[model samples]
Target: MAYSLVAEIWSELAFGMLVFALRFFTRWKYSGFRGMSYDDLFAVFAVTFWILETVSLYTCSAYGNNINLSVESALAVPDSEVPRLILGSKLAYCAWIFYILGIWTLKGVLLCLYNRLTMGLQQQRFVWVMMVVSVLTFLASLLWHILSCYPTYRAWQIKPYPGESCTQRKWNYVIICVLDVVTDIGMMAIPIPMLLRASLTVRRKVSLVLLFGSGIFVMICAVLRAYYSLVLIDDNTVALGWAAREFLVAAIVVNAPSIKPIFSDFKKRLTENYASGSWKSGTGSNAMSSGLPPYNGKNDIENNTAITSGNHKRTQAYKMSSIGRSQPKSESQDHINTATDADNDSTNSNIGKDGIIVTTEFKVSRR
Candidate 1:
């Protein structure tokens, strides 16, 4: 059971890290190093603490005391094993701290995204409210674990049998679980009204809502973890496994919107490759006789068109003009890439009132 649990934990962590890498690469590719934002930093902090939590989790599962042990069983534990138990207990405590930090840091990442997405809009108000709620909830959970366990050391104490409050940590789990779900709901709520009002098709709006609402799965994980922790109060390994699962779900959900670009790019490349292959197959004999490169439609367009903004004086109006995009209410990779292209073409093109021709990216850095 332990080996299988460990395998599940590590496999989930590897997948989470892959999505995280794509998120980071997407930001770096479009925005560059200078474009690194608070969300990026928060993502770094989140992954750091999650990795630490996993290390502590492995140690606890390997050596920690079983919460199911009765007072008699605890007392009967040999002195030789007491040291290992104590180390496990301490690490378990640290694991909880790491888990708290890692998950809450992910909240910070989402809030940063909301802050940027809602800039100059009425939805900014909700973002502020949710940010305050997030900070309060984070502090509440952190303090509960720190102070709820009387004398601190009692949390890990085995001899004399520390009470279930210190050992099982049911109440602490409840508090964190409730707050975790609440904050997730609040974050999901922020972008929804805006998306509904967005000038997009029903299908597009629904897709965007579903994307942000992916946090619902994370909330479900938190609830299940809490439910089982209270019911299976004796199983330390069960609780730890749930912790890892919740973290994995939260990491993927929060990073989903950020990594959409990767899927989009992959789809585009696949289409191009298929089209190129079809073109090559059709012109097999003629192309071989000419000994020239295959006729690619995409290359033909790129080579034929030179996007030049004739010597028309650049106007500040283009810079000042309000810009909007048909996308989820967040700073997406597509928008970022389009904006980067606009920046590169700043010297070459003069965008007039019809700003639709050129996309301008507005980044709100405030957290």
Candidate 2:
């Protein structure tokens, strides 16, 4: 009993955190943008699922009475008495309605994303068909859930003289399980073709799709829940525990909504770097040159003339100016230009290596 209560509390807390985190991440991702789209649908699903799971937690008496009932006692309670044993069992049924709604909304969003990703019209149409089929399957699940028990309240409540006998059908559960598996596979497969077309390295594209596809882990949890469902057929003790576990796992699975912002930030940084031109090959040299202004031509001539007249300070100044001009644009370039220019400038201050220094002459061309 203690273990069960602990598990229940942990599950509820985990589910609540996942919902909050998904909302936070979605808002963070789209904080700079306006309006809504399919991504926000996932956020809605997360919140909806959180609410439903909270209802289930309450209805299951996860926090309240009968908390000390042994596993055997829990199992012994008949379905008729289970509602009284629990707190919000009736409300839980209503919650499942919303859970089903969230599932349908999620499927629609996944299909829309697939459609946006697929390039060809034919592929897009195929995605639409699959989406429609998934929706119909989900609707069928909803119908089964609603009618699973004739007098649905009998699912939780017990009366002195039960009017109509309403029992759970194994086939109904099986149908829901089948629908889950099919849609899980369909959603997982939808991104493959588009991931293949992404303008990235093969490794990068594969990594991205696999990362996005990690939500398929939820399907694995669903499969496990289906297995537990078989055990739950006649055993409320086992069923309640397994259901709680599955709810927790589902909460974790829906957390894909939170990852969007991380991916968005990465893309944003890449865009900024690309736009700054800092990624160009020769830009580094210009960046370094801009930090230090070059010496003027007049100063170069005066120093060179003083150097040729054997003044050591003037010679040093002339050498420095020559060094600045001959310093190649990059570390890869040779310093031979510096040595030759310095030697010639020292020998004849009147003529520089590149051109003759004409201090008093100007040429004007008219064309």
Candidate 3:
């Protein structure tokens, strides 16, 4: 009894935590991208499943310390009191319907994520086909649950004779289990080929797809649940207990993988923030200035000094050259013309006026 209670508490806590974590991760990873239709729906389905599982667990007293016989014994007082217990049991069955729907919706969300990540029109079409098939299976499962026992209340309340009650159809359980296994397998298999073609490094691609493939654990849980479900047909006390245990275990296992992506995104964000903060604090403004070559420490001082000195020298030279070029051009031109005329007259005096005459040209000769 104590073990049962503990398992019950653990299951509740685990499912709640899984739901929170899955939402955290989904928001962290996909929230930045706009128009994420399926992710939100996935979160809703997760929350719904968690709620149904909690209600079912309580209604069935699956987590409680009392055994089935004890419950029956406690409620053996009067016919009037039996209805309440019976009602509670019926509510438990209804919760199961929700639980099954929750699982089916989760499968849809997973496939949608796969579809978003996968490339190619063909693969996308395949995912859509799977989605349609899964929805149909969910509907079929729901129909079976609703119609399994004619006057379904008989599935809960005991009849006059031990064997006379209209119970759930055996084929319904079989079909539900089969549909579950097929969907689980389909969900697990659909993402592999697309993941293999991802441009990420081989290691990263493998790791990511494997992380997604962790949903197969759900399939494993489903298989175990299905096996124990067979035991439920006998309605033996031990078999019922085992079946409940298996159901809780499978439910927890399947939801457990959803937490990984959430925690992964949290870790990544923390890492990026830490690196950015460290760079900001350590480098300061110097880093920015250093990025420009002209502002580098040694070169900046040298260049500044050279620029000041060169400017001063160029200013002095410009003043001196301006003053020198300020002379009167007309006076300079007249002086040059007078010197040229004197040189011509001297040359004509040395040579006679006529053709043969420079005969008496004064030539100073030193003895």
Candidate of highest TM-score: 1
- Give the per-residue lDDT of model 3 (tens digit) for 179-294: 88887777766656655654345686677567656766666666665666565654423333433454444444444434454455467668767663322111111001011112
RMSD of each: 11.3, 19.7, 31.0
What shift in Å separates residue 326 of candidate 2 from its native position after superposition? 45
Candidate 3 or 2, higher TM-score: 3
Summed over model 2, clashes come to 0
Candidate 1 C-alpha lDDT tens digits along 105-212 = 999998888787776677788889998999999999999999998899987888878877778888987899998888998888987767776655679769878988
lDDT string for model 2 (91-168, tens) is: 545545665666556566556555544423346767877878887888889988777765765544433322222332
TM-scores for all predictions: 0.78, 0.57, 0.59
**Candidate 2 C-alpha error for residue 93, in Å:** 3.0
Better of 1 and 2 by lDDT: 1
| Model 3 lDDT-worst window of ten | 282-291
- Could you tell me the C-alpha RMSD of candidate 3 in Å? 31.0
Instruction: Give the lDDT ranking, best first.
Output: 1, 2, 3
lDDT (C-alpha, whole model) for all candidates: 0.72, 0.50, 0.49
Residue 119 accuracy (lDDT) in model 2: 29
- Model 2, position 178: C-alpha lDDT score: 80
